[model samples]
Target: MGALTPEVMVRSLSQVLSFILAIALVLALLEGYVYLLFFRRPRALLGAIFTRTVQSAIAALMLLLFLRFLDRMGLIADLVAALGLAPLLTLPERVWAAWSALSPMPWRLLLPFFLILALELLIYFAGEPRPSRLGLAYVLILPALIGISFLIIIPFLFEVRLAFSNMAMYTAQNPEFGLRYGIENFIKVFTGPVAKDATFFEVFGRTVLWTAINVFFHVTGGLILALLLNRPMRLRGLYRTILILPWAVPSTITAMAWRNEFDFRYGLFNILLRNVQQFFTDLAAQAQSLPLIYDLLAWLSQAIHPVPWRQDPTWAFISVVMTNVWLGIPFMMVVILGGLQSISQEYYEAAEIDGASKWQQFRHITLPLLRPVLVPATILGTVWTFNRFEVIYLVTQGGPQEKTDILVSSLYKAIFQFYRYGFSAAFALVIFFILLLWSIFYLRITKGLRGVYE
Candidate 1:
C-alpha cells in the first residue's frame, strides 16, 4: 500500500465511524425486539410480532439504501483501494463464493447451523427450567459463542475440508475433495519426505525428544528456583523478579536474542568459553609441576572450543532446546511456587512431629498436596511446548539439514514454504490427534481433574 495521505486517513476514519454507527443501530433494534419478546411480555403477541417484522423490513431497506449511498459516493471503494485490496473479491464476495461452492451439498452446508439451533432450543427448554434464567445466561454468553463459531469452528471445519481435498498451489481455488483424496494426503504425509529429506517419523521422533528434554529441564529448574524462593530470604522479591524476566519478555524477542548469542564468533557463550579456557591455561602454566593441572588444562582445551551452535546438527538442536528451556522454566517456577505456597504448613509440621525427615515430608506431604496444581500445569506445559514454533523457527529455522524440525514447524514449512495445502492439513490433523491422545492418557494416569470434579 502507498503512504497514508491525509485524505485517505480522513476517508478511512469516516468509513469506520459509519460502520460502527450502522452496527450500533442494528444492535439497538435487536435489543428493543428482544425486550418486547422476552422481558416486556406484550399482551398482544401477534401485534408485537407484526410490528417487529415491519420494523425489521424497513430497517433492512434503510441499511441497503445507506450502503448504496456510500457506494455512489465511492467511500467504500476508496477505502478498499487505499488498503490495496482487490476490489473484485472483497471479504463478503469471498464468503459468497465459498457459500456458492457448497450449494451442491445444501445439507452439508446447513448441518452445523441446524445443530447449533437445535442445541440452543434444547438448552432453552431443558436447561434451568426457567425462561428468564436461560435467556439471561444465553444472552451473556452469546457473543463469545458467536465469536468462537466464526473464528475457530468455521476455520477448523474449513481445514478439515481442505484435508480431504487434493489442494496445492496449482489447485487451491478448485480442488477435488473425497475420501480417496484424504487417504492419499495422509498416506503421502507418512510415506513422503515432509521437508527436504526429513521423513515424517524422523521429524516426529526429534520433536518428542525436543519436548521431553525441554520439559524435563523446565520442571527441574523451576522447582529448584521455586523451592529457594519459598524460603525466607533477604532478596527474595528481587530474585524472583530477575528470574522471571525470561518469561516476561516476548518469546520472539528472546529467541532472536538467544540466536544471536549462539553465533560462532563474538557470541556471549563462546566469549565466556574462551575466557575460561585462557584462565585455565594461565593456571596450568603457573602450576606446571602439578601433573593433574596439566591434565585438567588438556581437558579444558578439548572441551572449551568455540561450539558451532547453528552449523552442526547436534549443537543446533541443543541451541534451540537450551533457548526453549530458559524461556519455559520461569513459567513453571511461578506455577509451582503458587502450588507450593497453597500447601498448608500444618501438614509439614505434623510430618516433622511424626519424626519424618525432609525427604519423607516432601515425598509424602508436599507431593500429594501439590498434585492438583502440578498436574494441570504439566499438562498445559506439555501442550504449549509441543506446539512451540517461535524458538525453533527463530533460533534454528529447523536448519542444519532440518535435523531440529518439529511437527508444527514442519507443518508450517509444508504449507508456507512448499505450498502443499492438503498435505499440511492432513499433517496438522495427525499432530492434533497425537496431542489429544497423549492428553487423554496423561489425564487418566494422573487423575488430574479428580480434585476439580470432587
Candidate 2:
C-alpha cells in the first residue's frame, strides 16, 4: 500500500530473484538424483554431477547477490519484521512463531510442486531413448497449466468448500462446514428466494428465456446481414463495418447508452415514436375521405405511442434483451461470415444447375456445410449469453421488483448485496451444472463434435 520507492523496488526484485534461485537449486538437485538412479554409465553420472554442481553454484551465487542487494538497500530488517521475526525474540521464540504461522502446513502448495517434479522425471525418462516431443510440449505449456490451476481450479475448489459451509455475513468468521450444510444450501437455492423476492426457478426460467431470445435474434440477425454482405454489393464493406459498430463498442458503454435511449420522454425511441404518431394523425385527417386509409392511419397513430420501457417489467426485460442482442450480433456475423465464405462456390453452382431454389440450396448444402462452424459458435454464444451480466446489471439491474434478474445477476446480488456467500456459491455451482448439462445434451443432439472430429 505504500508508495513505490527505490528501496521497495530493490526489495521486490531481490525476493523474486531469491525465489527463482531457490527453485533452480531444488530442480538441479532433483535432476542430479534422477540421473544417478537412471544412468548406469560412469561418464553419464559424472556429467550429471558436474552439471548439477555448476547449476547449484550459479543459483547460490545469484541468491547471495540478491541478499547482499537487499541488505545494502536496508530492506533486510523490513523483510524480517514482515515475517514476524522480531529482533527482541529469542531464536527459539522466532522458530516457534514461524511454525505456528505455518500451522496448516501448506500441503496444497507443496503437493503440486512435488507432483510436477515427478511428472517431469517420468517424462525425461520416457523421452531419453526416443526424444519425444511431448516433454517439450509440457515444458511450453507448464506456465499456462500453473496459471489455470491458480486462477481457475483453485478458486473453483474454494467455492465448492464455501458451498458446503453455512457461511454468511453473520457466521463469516466461523462458518460451519458439513454435508448437512451443503444439502441445506442446495435446498434453499431451489425453494427459497435467490434475490429478495425472486425464487430460483423464476430467475432461472427468465434466464433461459433471456438467453434464448437474445441468441435467436443474434443468430438470425447476424446471418441475414452476413448473407447480404456475402453477395456482390457496392459499399458492402462500409455497411458491414457500420453494422458491427454495436459490437465493436464495449457492452457496458452500449448498455448505458441504450438505457438512456429507453428513457420515456427524451429517448430517441420515444421521440421517433411520437413523431411517427403525429405524422400518422396528420395523414389520417388528410385522408378522411377514404375511410379505409383513414382508419388504417388512425390505428397506426394509436399504436405508435411511446412505451415505458424502464418502468414496466416486461419492457425492461425487453430492453436488456434488445441491448444484448445488438451487442452480440457482430460476433455471430463475423463467425457466420467466415463460415459462409468457406463454403465452396462450386457447391452453389452445382445446386443451381440442379434447379435448386435459393432456399433449397441453403437447406441442403449451406447449412450442412456450415454446421461445423455454426454449431460451435452457437454453443459458445449460448453459454456467453446465459452468463451475461453486464447488460442486465448496467441497464436494468434486475429492476422493477427484481423482475429482470437472471441466475448470474441473482448470484452476484446474493453475494454482494445480500451477503449470502454460502448461498451464492451454491447458486453458482447450480448454474455451472445447468450449463454443463445443457452443453452435453446440445452436443449429443447436434452431433457438433462429430463434425469437428470428422
Candidate 3:
C-alpha cells in the first residue's frame, strides 16, 4: 500500500472530530430528555446538558490526543494492514478504527446504566405521587435480572444451540464448516450404536436407582441420629458433634480413606474377615470329633472370605453408595434436626395427656409436622445424589467397566474423554429435562408446600 498522505490524515482527523461531536450532541439531547421528562426540572435541564457536553468534549479531546500519538508512530496504518482492512478503509473508517483501538466505552456497561435510568424515570412518571420503596426496589433489581440472563440463561441457550448443531472438535477448529442443525445428537443418545452397551436409558435408570438408594439411607440414618440427639441425654451436644464430624470432614478425603479400607488385601475390612476365618478354622480343628459341628465350622471358614469391594461391579456400586451415604447423612440430619426444633411442644404434651404411646406421638405429631421440612429436603437430597460425582469418582472411579457411571459422570466422560461436544450437550439437556420434569411432578404430587405456606 502507498504511504498515508497528509490529505488522508487531515480527512481522517476531521471525521474523528465530527464523530465525537455527534456523540456529544446525542448525550446533550439525552440529558435534556431525562431532566425534563423524569426530573420535571426544565430550569436545571440546560445546566445538565451543559455539564454532559463539557464531559463529552473533554473525553473527545483526550481520545483525539491518544489517537494522534498512534498516528505519529504509524501504528494505526500498521494495524489496518495487519487486519487486511487497508485496501477497504475510507477516511471515516480509519477514524472509527482509531477510536475502537483505544477500546472506547463498551455498550455492555453503558446499555445497562441507561436502561436502569430509563426504568427509574418510567416508574417516577407513572404516578402523580413519588415512587414507592417497592417501585425503587423493582427498578434496582432490573439490573440483577439482566445479570442473571447473561450469566445463567445465556450459557443455557448456548448449550441448547450446541445440542442442535454439529459442534464436534472438527467443527470447533474449522470456522468454515457448516453446522448441521438436527436432533441427530439426541438420537445418538438413545438407539445409536454408542447407546447399545451403556445406553442413555440404562445410565438414567442407574442414576435414579443410585439417587433412590442414597436418599433412603441418608434420610433413615440421619433421622435416627437426629432422634437420638434430640432426646434429653448425657453429653448430647458432644454426641451430636461427634456424629456430625463425618460430614464436616472433606468428602474427597473421606472417600479416599474408605476406598483404602475396602481394599481386598491388607485393608481393615479384609484383615478382620481373615481373622474371623482363622478363628473358624481353629474352631473346626478343635471340633473334629463332633462331626456336625466340624462341618458347620468348615463351611463358616469358607464363607468368611475377603469381599472384593471395588473390583466387582455390584460391590463397587455398593462401595460408592456407602461413601456417599456417609457424606450425605449429616446434611439430612441437620435439616431434620431444624425441623424437629420447630415442632410445638404443646402437641407432644397433649398427646401424652391422652395416654398416647411414644410411637403414637411420633406417628401423629412428629412425622406430620416434619413433612413440610423433610419433603423439600428430600427432593434436594435426591437431586444432589443424582449428580453426586465426587464420592463415586473418588472411591470407585466409576470402575468395574463403567458399571457405576451415573448420568452426570457419563456426560463428563463424553465431553472430556471423547471430545463429543455436541453429543455431550445433548446428553446434558436430556438430563436437565429429566430433572426438571421430575421436580415438577414431585412438587405437584406432594402439594406439601401448601402446608408450609399456611
Instruction: Give model 2's TM-score versus the native structure.
Output: 0.73
Worst 10 residues of 1 by lDDT: 122-131
In candidate 2 the C-alpha lDDT for residue 283 amounts to 96
**lDDT-best of 2 and 3:** 2
Candidate 3 lDDT over 1-454, as tens digits, reads 7689999999999989878865654454445333333333213555446545544654564456544544443335446567774434444447666766755565533553465455435434442332343554444455556458657875786577667667677776431212454467888988652322577877888898999999999999999888878877899888888888888988778888998988999678889999999999999999999999999999999999888987889988888888889888888998899899899889999999999999998899999999988888998889889887888778877777788889988887788777777777888998999999988888798885677799
Ranking by lDDT: 2, 1, 3
**Which pairs in model 2 have colliding backbones?**
none
CA lDDT of each prediction against the hidden true structure: 0.78, 0.80, 0.74
lDDT of 3: 0.74
User: What is the per-residue lDDT of model 1 for residues 250-276, given as tens digits with 9 covering 90 to 100?
Assistant: 888989999999998988998888888
TM-score winner between 1 and 2, please give it. Answer: 1
Which residue runs does candidate 1 get wrong by more than 4 Å?
Answer: 1-133, 446-454
Q: What is model 1's C-alpha RMSD?
A: 10.3
TM-score of 1: 0.77
Instruction: Compose the digit string of candidate 2's lDDT tens values, residues 74-129.
Output: 33445556766444334434555676677564553465457546644543443334
Q: In order, how many clashes per candidate?
A: 0, 0, 0
Residue 282's lDDT within candidate 1 is: 79
RMSD of 3: 12.4
